[model samples]
Target chain A: MIEFIPVLLVIFTGFSGIMINRNIVMKLISLDIMNTGMVCFFVLISKMSGSFPPIIHSLDEMNLDFVDPIPQAVIVTAIVIGFSTLSLSIALTAMVIERTKKVKVDDIEKKVGT
Target chain B: MFLVLNFVYLFILFLLVLLRRLENLQIFFFVSFMFFLPFMKNMDEIFEGIGGVHIVFDDTSRLFVLMNVLVFLGVSLKMRGKKKIRFPFVLTFITLNFLYASADLFNIYVLLELLSLETMILISSGGKVKQFWSSVKYMIFGSVGMNIYLLGVGMVYMQNGTFDLTKILRVSNVSLVLIFTGLLVRTGFFLYGMWLPSAHSSAESEISAILSGVIVKGGIFSILRILSFEPFSSITPWITKVSAISSFLAVIFAITSKSFKRMLANHTLSQLGFIMSNVETAPMYAFAHALFKSWLFILADELPSERFDEMGKRLNLFPWIFLILGSFSIIGIPGTIGYAAKSSLFKNTYNFERFFLILASIGTSVSFSKLISRRPKISGWGGIKENLHNLYFSILVIGGGVVLFEFRMKSFIQSFLLFIVGFLLHRMIGKNLKELRNPLERIEVNLFVISTLILGMILWLIS
Candidate 1:
């Protein structure tokens, strides 16, 4: 259970970073930080058992010495998903910035006034 | 077999999206219909593990998938002759086919993120600055919610060593609470629903219609899924009270809101609360809310502006027919699908919760009663065929009321009495409806989320 402490710390830091940023770009950066933290959190949970990567051609090659492979695969998938959403967020923020010409959400809200 | 059909559906949709020339509305409609046929064929039984061990199909998924397809068909028809939205509309439906059917907890997260991203695209696709702002608001909350959900998934994986929903070793309460909070933010729960009205009101009508109707239901499957785990049932009872409070409060917000579309948006929030309070019968309530609310939104766009003050003067080219049908359905009059769904929802609940839900319904009736009083101009009668979607859903709402098994004279009397009370309240409140205040309006989004998380934590620890 102590191995989970660092993972929880990384995630909590990322979450706080998200809440503190007022600029959309900063917020996106904070979101990326949080997602990266989560990705690492997923990967590190499996590493507590073994450091060796799980790569085997057949069932016979499987051994107790290898780390769990599922979380590793999921983290890669998570990274890809995180990348796509981040890029989409950047593109959307660009559109908003182009219109409002302001980076802070508070400033933009004042100008847009909707 | 279901997997193959989904692949085929994806193939056609991809081609449609990639080749702009092939993006005609009819082809999109044809593809959605072709994919829906199999679901209709297999509606009677659950197809467990059809394609993979991780994927599970059951009655809840079936109802949601049906709503997704049918509402898409209706909404796409409503967008006919409109330019510039063809691409995003096709793209939105592309990922939705997989969102409900997949049973893995993590898979649902990715699909939900994709669905929300696509919806943001669609909402921003309206090409207005206000629309951009609204979608931006949604993206902020949505991103935060899903990240928290991912963290919760990690916590679940830490305990269970697996992501499969059907097989769980153990799930801690805090993790489940985190997951539930993430979904609730998107599902438009009471304090968390601030993003909903703005997002729903600012988008183009058809887009708002679809978002309000069912796309936000990304949470329903997981909510129901988590509720089934016996160890985690501690949080179950609080779900009802939370949803009921949101339902009644949202109706209060709707009754006072001055903007026409925003009022409709608030009602969607309120109805979502109603739908959430009784998850056993949620699909029926959801289906009812989906059809009629979308119809109201489509008709609302026909008005000149969202101002209530101007609306009282004249409604030129307004389709009063659809409004009347939708209002009757919304207010839960005796012969509409809303009545049927609400009655069934009420019958299964205790007297106290039912009374509170009825109070919410009374507020809904009061909110909509004002709309029915407004008189539209002569042009409303002439252009009935132009709105094929209205005609389509109109039949469903009224027809569904007739066929639903929950019909009872007691239910009818309660609903009728509520309708009368709403009208009297509307009359007393009169024209100063705009002067009413929304108490939750002043709460900051970030603060609201933190407090809600704390609240969920406290709920879990106590329960």
Candidate 2:
């Protein structure tokens, strides 16, 4: 439970970073931070149940204590989605900087008045 | 066997992407394949287990699949001569088809992520800097929304120990609110949908048609599925209240918007209010709205992007004629598809919600009437190809009217009266309208996401 405090703190920091920053790249980084925090939270919460890996190669292992496997699997998928989102967002940020020469959102808005 | 069909379709689409030759034949084959899908219906395995494709042959899925096929067919018409467009276009359709059939929670989440990613790719394909920015904003907001969804998924899994929607018996109020919040954020219900007008309006008409027509409704459908759970049915009344407020605000915004495309985009959001308030009629309204909204977007895409006051003048006969029909379809005139769908709501809903929805519909007609310009005395014949395109869409709209002629005579007269009142209202304030800026700016969307999640959590705790 104590470890959960830092994870919540990190999530809050990432969230405020996204809300307060004006630069697109900064926002992308903040989003990554938030995703990492969520992944960490999922993994941490799953540990409350058991300490061993979820594998059961033998009947004895089946009776032995094991951590939940579902959240671990979900975390893997979430991490992959997070990576794709980060890379694509970075690519878009590069394109934005290429055309407008400014990473600040207001400057870009001024350039293209959308 | 049902799941295998999806893999086979993906393989074919991949082969099409690789072998770009004979593109016309390939498109014809794919369109025919899609249209042929609805007839091979089986009622046996409506509820499949986790880690497998889940589909049903119920009324909503039927309507959902039909709209998906129709939009794909319409968009394919504009794909000729475009570079690298067919790949994502077909990819998005495939993802949406699977999404409509998914019954499990995790399956829906994964499919939704795929849909979002593919749509972002499609939007950025336009090669304009504005399109890139809009796509980027879309990605940012979309990822944030999904993260919130994941958080809810975590809570549900922690509480219920499974991600199978049918297997879970009950959920705490906290997780339910978190889940609904995630769905609402994606649907762009109310203030959270600031990214919609810019993203939908900036794309080419075909792309915009799909975005406005089907993709937005994807979020609403997810919510409908969630609310149908017996434990969560209690939330329906609250959702109806929220939707009424959203409908009214969105209509006001649409009525005041300066650009025709933006006005139509807001109208899309406003219609979500109507569909969400009544669960029984949601699917029907969604089906009709998809047809008429896409028809309208396709027609509006042909007009120049100048203000309504400027471009409506000196219009050709093609746009003029279809524009009226498209508006009629959207306004639910007596003989249109919109009339059939709106009449369904009138039959089922009663009291304040019904009154508010009707007001919102009239506001929709009023706002659209502002875009209507008088026919020029001497109209020029436009490009033959474009006129043919208009004629094609007009036939579809008229066909919808003819096919959906089951509404009562009273429905026609009521809608006609509403249309006249809306037009008179439009004439009064048409000149005073001004441009409304995007309310959900980049930073603000992030704020709303977190605040909404927190609000849901607090509401859950209180309840």
Candidate 3:
């Protein structure tokens, strides 16, 4: 359980990067990093019960030592969702560039109607 | 079976992305998925959410689901034939529904991240530097909050050995303070959510409608779900007192804000404070507040500020019906939706806490009264078709909420009296429209934050 502390720190660093950074692409990347940190945390939690993956072979009975399969399945879905979000963010970045010719958030705001 | 339904929705989202070229077909598919959600078998499993079935399938959630469907339909109609933000918008909407359906804490975090990404897209579509900067700030604040929330989740998992809310709730008195603190940060409570005003106010009007209306409510819903799992009565009295005080202070700040949109954003925070104070009120109030507030924000967005001078000069007879209807609904006038929510809210809360509710109601009336005072004079009904449609939509939602929902009649009457008194006081102190500051200053910002903190602390101490 204590091993999850580093993952939390990574998530915090990613958050601070997103907050303090002014560049749009960097902020998006920071968001991705934050997401990666969360994935790590969840995966680690799932593995707390044991290191073995929850799979069965025809030649063997149920393996009691295997870790919980539920968190893994949830994480898989989260990863797919995360990828779609990243792609959407990239698309948004492209649109912002097309319309305003800049990637800096501060520069973009100055051009739009105040 | 419930999990299968969630997967189906997820599958439909993928299909939407694939069919991005066929805009109308994609919208139709999205609508079909929403319509079919209720009928899906084993929905109880998915609806039970990470927290449990009581939080998901309860009367409150049913109302929330209904509101989501209606708001989406309205927004989709407004975007009919517009290809530019369609597919991504639908994708975000699916993610929102997934978040709502999710029972687990980690799933909520994932869904919230998706929401933040979607909102950034919508805001930056306007391509303004200020908007982008605001979105950046929003992203930053959101990340910090979610991270803090993760730490709390980690702690809870460490303590209870499970991330599911129902499982954790069964083991009482397990670091309740840590869990509440983490959730407070995520939900935009007091100190942590300062980024909200800048982000919500700076976004395009329609996007602001979603941000103010639905997104913040998602946070509130998550917190409320946790609180509900363990009764408020079981919690320390100090926690309840602190929340109530914070809400009262937030409402005062809301009333003093100058910009139309910023004022509305503050109002969202203020209402959140009130709802938090009344956690024991049937979760239905929270759901109702989300629906009404979203509708109100959408109407506020459509107030036509660009042509304020011209529109003000040309104000006509029929539009007054909408203004009256909307103001009544928002201010909790008898026979309106606000009345229903306020009545239920007041009844469940401690009578000693009446001052906070009264002040919040006054703040709402005063803020809207400012809008009415600035109304453009009507020249004629030239844009009858557009105005009529807007009026129809506004009335439909406000009327539907009051008539269909069960509200205590006596409480409605009392709340109406409070609204009237507040409106009267506002009229007495009303300022010239031209004299009001268009853009708020740094001084005002400092004052707003300082006052909210001081007031929140005072209320907490006194209570």
- What CAPRI-style quality would you assign to candidate 1? acceptable
Please tell me how candidate 2 rates in CAPRI terms.
medium
The digit string of per-residue lDDT tens for model 3 on B290-348 reads 55565555555455563333345334444555665666677777666666777777777
Write model 1 residue lDDT over A1-114, tens digit each, in one string: 777687678767766665666777887787788788888788887886788767777887677578877777777877887788788878877888998899987787777655
lDDT of 1 by residue, B398-455 (tens): 9888888465788879888998998899999856755454444322454456556656
Sorting all predicted structures by TM-score, with the top scorer first, yields: 2, 1, 3
Runs off by more than 4 Å, candidate 1: A56-64, B21-23, B41-53, B229-233, B316-318, B383-385, B434-444, B455-463
- Cα error, residue B146 of model 3, in Å, equals 1.6
List pairs with backbone clashes in candidate 2. Answer: none
**lDDT (Cα atoms) of all candidates against the true structure:** 0.76, 0.76, 0.61
For candidate 1, report its TM-score.
0.92
Predicted structure 1: lDDT: 0.76
Tens-digit per-residue lDDT, A12-114, candidate 2: 7887787889888898899999999989889976886887998878887777667877778767887888898789878987998999899898899789767
TM-score of each: 0.92, 0.93, 0.75
Sliding window of 10 residues with minimal summed lDDT for model 2 chain B: B50-59
Name the runs in model 3 displaced over 4 angstroms. A1-114, B1-58, B169-182, B231-243, B280-282, B300-319, B351-353, B374-376, B379-392, B401-413, B432-463
Interface Cα RMSD, each model:
2.9, 1.8, 6.3
